[model samples]
Target chain A: MKYKYWRRSRVIPFTLLLSNLVYVSFGLDPAASAPLVADTAFTKSAFYDQNEQCFRCHGNSKYTYFNPVSEKDVSATMCENRVIHRNEFYTANHRSFACVDCHAAEYDTFPHPGQLRMEAPYNCIDCHGYDEQYAQYHFEEIEEEFQQSTHYTANGDAFTCWKCHNPHTYRINIRNSTSMQQSIAYDNQICLNCHSDFERFQLLSDREEINLIQKHEWLPNQGLHFSQVRCIECHARLNDSLMVAHRIMPKDKSVKRCVECHSQNSLLMSSLYKFQAKESRSDAGFLNSIILNDAFVIGANRNIILNRISLIVFFASLGLMLMHLLLRMIFKRND
Target chain B: MTEKVYHYPLWIRLWHVFNALLCLVLIVTGISMQFSEPNRSLVPFDLAVSIHNSAAILLIINYLYFLIVNRLSGNRMHYKITEKGYVKMLITQFRYYTLGIFRGEKTPFPVSEVRKFNPLQQFAYIVILYWFFPLIIITGLGLFFPEMIITRIFGISGLFLTDLFHILSGFVVSMFMIVHIYFCTMGTRLTSLFKGMINGWVEIH
Candidate 1:
């Protein structure tokens, strides 16, 4: 009886070891294979779960596919639409929020319902409008401005906030940015993404593809203007309530006059360089002196002291010349 | 017949006239650009830019011609300040303009083939043509090709400094033009010097 008990113990241990080996070789986790409960309990549990739970599948470049031949979970081709770069998401402005905060709780299911893909995304105003906490941001005014924009007028209900600003990555860079050039580059990218890209542009409008160079041919030094200033500097209507002007005017209404931005009271002072102007209010008594820190726009950046001195010298010279002419005429008459 | 001298050659006269025209155009357009307003402008901004740029280009070419001819020809001798008692000569010429001429005094400096300009005129021309003209040209070019300009100088935008220099040089040249024209009237007759530029001869009375 003791011998029989020893043999049974050995057999049971070997069986357990073999099962474990098979499970490991097949890349199967019992916990992962557990059936998903599509119920209130699961949704409530997922609501409190960390971002890693959602990132496990969506953040991965490759999707797991069960291969019958290999009897294992092998990596298949990347699902581009489903993939979200973990690093990018974490660094973005919305990083603090849980995925479920924006996404519906129904997405907690193992295989998210196909219907969820067609779910209407939240509008910017849905959360921000009339909220006292966000009152300072002026979302209501921005909404009003957006309603009047060409983008809204053209696309009607089809256009969303996501058209220009990607909720996943959008940041308040213009107001807070230290470098104007960097802000210009970042902000212009949003416009160029549609305006410069034919495929993306066609998604919004039925017009033929535009060549930016050909369109802006009248502007001297087109490349310099493009790099130095945001597209909205000339395109968008100025709004005092919003940090950025959302009321994008039609092409015909856009600012074309060079002096509009290249003057003592530059239009850019209220728009592209608004934050910079505010920060450096003490301008050494020079007209548009704040612009001199970042750029040198002709007609805009004049030194008050230099201008006054020049005027004085010019008038004095003119007066002396006039006197000289007067004396010459008098001497001639006397002679 | 009045005593006359051939002080200006065909090429010199041509260059001078073209230079004067370009300078006038540039000055007008430059002022318009400087004081341009969005609604009210002296010259329409677009037209001013085109005219200013074209005039600037022509001025550059005219200046080059002046420099090359001055280098190659004996005309350069007129610009040289080599005379003895030069400062005294300048003072005497100054006195002529300020007080002597009203008293019907003869000019301290006379027009001759060897002396195209008086001591004071020579000094003024040298400063304006050789110094201020080149300064305006270089700074104007810098403004034209803004990308090539230094991004900053002494913690100030280089373009701003360049523009300021261009304006200052332009102001000096403009003042010189006015004074130079007035000085030209002090010749034997009021219109004699004007006729001299056109005919390549000056009445030496």
Candidate 2:
């Protein structure tokens, strides 16, 4: 009986070990096969191990390259293409991902083959499109917007999401930012990176470089407008479903009317101030109450009670004056 | 026979004309901005803003001149209610306008060298110029440089409160302007006060 029990115990553990080995070799682990949605808790040790192997070379500021002629690895200064900031990568939205998840396994080879560099980069839709887990993000809809935008229309396939949004470091600033000013600055920097930089802009268009100040001189308090609000507030075609509007309109198509932002029903309430408006919807006593904390737009920040009272007082004063005039006329006729 | 009193000097007359013109422009533009729709504005929004700003600047200059001249000259006394029974005096003037004027009773307080304005006129001028004028000007300046305005007051937006005060004071001043024009007709003739303002002379019967 003792001999039989020992054999059974040994057999069961061996069998469990063999199954785990098979799962790793075939990428058939139940957790691994599951959908890689946002906020998924990754296997920490394995995820770090996979990424550390790639980062050993990529994360180093003084990365070395193989010198075939010299028969040695020559130290080289880090370039933008190779260097990945360790902190930024770890804190990013895709922090839980393994390096090989997006990149091909061929990149794991040391002194990567030249053909690997030519491999087409993954588009956002390649992994995210048609996936029910990512449907809420509307990646397909963003692709549609990008296709219709001025950037895509003018430059064709040359304009990609990476031009404005660096996937390695991109985060949802509008929703997560501590201040509106910070969010405005962060978003505007993405547009200004290309729009303001003549060298960067020339890559997209050969048109004469724009003088932003002169172009926006028609705006009242141009500096204040630029600092307080994002460029997309007026320039982008608003979509109620999207958190940020991606379909940028041409200059002529952009909003030029002051009433668009300075009315009781301000477009800013839906665009720039969307999150704040959502948070403060309970205080519906005043129009544009969300903006009251940051700004006081004339005609937009109106109190209904004050409006009615002012109108009554104005008409009452006029009525009293008219009554006095009528009484004087009647007395004169009697005399 | 009529006696001519030199109640208004050349500077005062010029100031009155400019003040009237600027105030009228501000009132129209201000109301258009406050009440008019974007598409159906009484005055086009941009043009209204430009005109309103220009008029406001001129009014500020005109107001400063009035203040300096009043301080240097004796005109300030006409605005002071120093009499012991001034409330009674105001009531009497009010009754004269509401009842006695139609009955052809003589004015209890007529225009003279010592008193350029009656008690009622004195009170209205004091409240409008001293109280509402400064309130509107301060609040207007606050709106112009919003950064300088306090961010909050009693847990409410300071800018909103400033705007509310500006609108309220503006409404009162507008009402006063209309009544002031009508009151000018109470002189010997409908055009008498207007002529007096122009020529710097009032005809007392």
Candidate 3:
């Protein structure tokens, strides 16, 4: 007892202590006890899946575009890159997924453990196919022509999709990473290979071939400083990395800007880029585009005035000199 | 026997001054026409067009007077007459300019009657008076016709062609004037030629 409290006090109270403690706690409820601090929510693992496992609605979990041969739906896996129409964007491999993945539209997660999905799944090819949709307006056709041309050979990576198309977009658009204007840097990469071959070619001719190339593109060999640079570079405005132009022009494969940007990277610039069977005038396809603009109209109007001024000045000055000469001859009569 | 020492007559001098002043006015008007804009048509367009046109006409009239008077005077240019030894004198003059002019030697081409102009003067005057001035006049007249000067003077056909001629000539003269002014300053001293034109007298040395 002395060891428990003090032996002298324990003699009077040991029996009462046991009886009162039992009485006080006998009516206490087990459910209503104060929760232990160790059981708090702050220390809990937060990966709540909302218990809505996505596979139930999306058909199958591990389905792929490659296995579409065994099944019809997954066959469209490769259909992601299938361009929809003549002017439609070349869709990359994107699959439609749950809306709560990327778009942070309404984030109610107390501690946002990860990203809130925003975009609906990419289900574009559920309607279109490569053979049915893109075969008509293929860059593949352009590349084939480029291959047959004298400018390029099959050894180049002309058949590849990444070479010609920006996979992130539905349309072929340029995006600026470094510059203010939308730059077709990879496209111009094609032009630089041949255009910058000045020092190698050693052609001493006065032809404007070299100058024209330098005029529209970058050439390190020539000491030209560009103020306006290329038409596409400035004309195309930047949207993130995407270069959208003020005018709604589709991604043309044959513009001068295209030549500068893409250069002879594709077979399209090759001498055999045309298949005479299908009428190979395809390299000239984009070049043949001539829109009658008003800028030239203004210049023509101004030139009329400019030409008249020049002619009048010439003739009037002529008459004055002649009058002087005639008078001089008449005055020489005294001699 | 009362031959005048000063060759420039009063009427010719007045016309020269008039033409020069008119050219200045035209330049000013042209400048104001393009005020605040490189190529914009503004309200001052009418004022500029009228002033430039009027000055142009006045210049042409004055130029005619100057041409007739200068030709009659036999003193439109500076020249030298080295008698029968003209070749020797010309060679000497050429050498003096090419070699001796640097050393402050006298000019071989001296002022004279009958052959008042040196080769350079004759060439320059021929270009300016014959080539340049006519180009401006034809162009100006063309423009003036567009403003209806041709309808009162020539008729419908003239009116139709006036603008065409005026515009074309104005362009030619403008180009010529640019080159002329540039060359005019290419003298040994830039201001010397200008001063010579200002007062009809230049120090021979």
Candidate 4:
């Protein structure tokens, strides 16, 4: 029995060392990730040692979709001849590597618009550890902002940069996408995704509660264009210049009324003000009723007030110059 | 020697001088537009707009006048890209600017009624007259009438894209000015082109 115990003890130690060697050699199957659709042989080809190799097979499938663009066919067959979008690899240095390098997704060949079954955008951190070189990436903040945005807030994971941004072209070419045209017109989706829902702002109890009042320009739809009001109305600038009118001011509602100059719905502003309620699009749903191409005639219509003020200042400077000249003449003659 | 060296008409001289002057005004005003103000514009944005618009119209009209006057006078033959002369002319002028001018060497191509500009000058003038001028006018007009363009052409939705195109055109012009000013230093004398624009006569050494 003692002899048998000694033999077992010798075998256990040997097995432990052997198991340690297995773990070190393979790294818990980082290379052979099962359930993933891609052929691992491609990864074994040693081409994926750099990022550039990832593109060899993946880029082959890039333009394979049924493209209706008559002037430019974006089909995969054409991609071999056509130049890859420069902005796709706009980084200082880009890698052309195997498909499984970054996107470990299974490539579906049979489907019409061959879908890429890949990990989520946030999951990119797995292999791509916080790179010191790309420390200023700000990817997390952008991701968070996109999530908190009202457009996707509760339903965040439903989208990624690929939704609105085509990574291939990497251009926000507004020429395409008939559906996106309406959103661009109705609200600045780029900004709205981060800012508080303009529609959620309930009206203040009194006009005294509103701040940053200017001229009341009645937009179409009984002045219910919250999107227009929050952006263009208060933050108006001449010749597409940037300026601030609301919220940036000290938060004192008594300072200036929000609706004084944002007067699309000014007649209703009084009744709404008495209610002292917050602006909620859900409450009235009047935001959808905003009309287009309405004359922007609102308030006392003194949009050029800033322009006039500058004119006055210019004239004052001229007058001062003339006065100085006259004083110089008198002093010189006396001397 | 002062017997009007070649066939450059008085109208051509006047238009060229006027164009150069107005371009300077537009560029300066354009700088102020970009850097100066948000709402309180010191430069009367309206006046600037009017000045730019009028100047652009004059330029467009002058472009037509150039084509018409030159063709009518049968002077169009001077600017043509002839098979035998094109490459030879271009190389000769390039060599003059790079090496000959600095060495105090005489200009290879002398001015005459038929071939006023050296090949380099002809190429530069042709590009400026055709490509740069047309782009500026079209882009400038697009900016002034954003509503008309967005509504009539692509349905009010393409406003931002149109705006972007206008801004890009401005950027291209900005780049051209930087390069144009640098190259102007390579003139026979450092300020010869400047003097020529003002006086309508380039001194021939």
Using DockQ as the measure, what is the rank order of every candidate, best first? 1, 2, 3, 4
**Better candidate number, 1 or 2, judged by DockQ:** 1
What tens digits encode model 3's per-residue C-alpha lDDT throughout A207-302? 344654435343321211121133334223222211122221222332332122212222122211111212323233222111001000011112
Q: How good is model 1 by TM-score?
A: 0.85
Worst 10 residues of 3 chain A by lDDT: A289-298
Stretches of model 3 off by over 4 angstroms after superposition? A1-335, B1-5, B31-43, B71-108, B113-115, B147-199
Interface RMSD of each: 1.6, 2.0, 17.6, 15.8
In angstroms, how far off is A178's CA in candidate 1? 1.7
**Candidate 1's residue-wise lDDT over B1-205, tens digit each?**
8999988889999999998889889888888888888987889888898899889998888889898998798788888888898888989999888898778888888887577888888999999988998899999998888889997898777878898898889888887888788778878998899998999899986
DockQ of predicted candidate 2: 0.43
Q: Give the alpha carbon lDDT tens digit for every residue of A157-259 in model 1.
A: 7999988877666655665565777878989999999999998899989999999999999998787799888999899999877668999999999999999
- Per-residue CA lDDT of model 4 for A76-102, tens digit only, reads 543452344332443101112222333
Query: Lowest summed lDDT over 10 consecutive residues: which window, candidate 3 chain B?
Result: B34-43
Candidate number with the higher lDDT (1 or 4) = 1
Docking class of 1: medium
With a 3 Å backbone cut-off (N, CA, C), the pairs that clash in candidate 1 are none
- Candidate 2, residues A1-335, lDDT tens digits: the string is 32332243335543343344334322255543332222234334246777888888788787776888999989978776678776667655455556665565677887677886765555666545665655666888988998889989998878888888776666556755556777798899989998899999998898999999899988876766887789999999988877678899999999888777777788889999887777666445667788776667776777777777777987887798888888878887888
Off by over 4 Å in 4: A1-232, A235-335, B1-4, B36-47, B83-85, B147-205
Candidate 4 achieves a global lDDT of 0.43
Candidate 3 per-residue C-alpha lDDT over B6-121 given as tens digits, one digit per residue, 9 for 90 to 100: 33446656776786668667756654442313234332444555667677877887888777777776545432233566556657755753455445555566434444444444
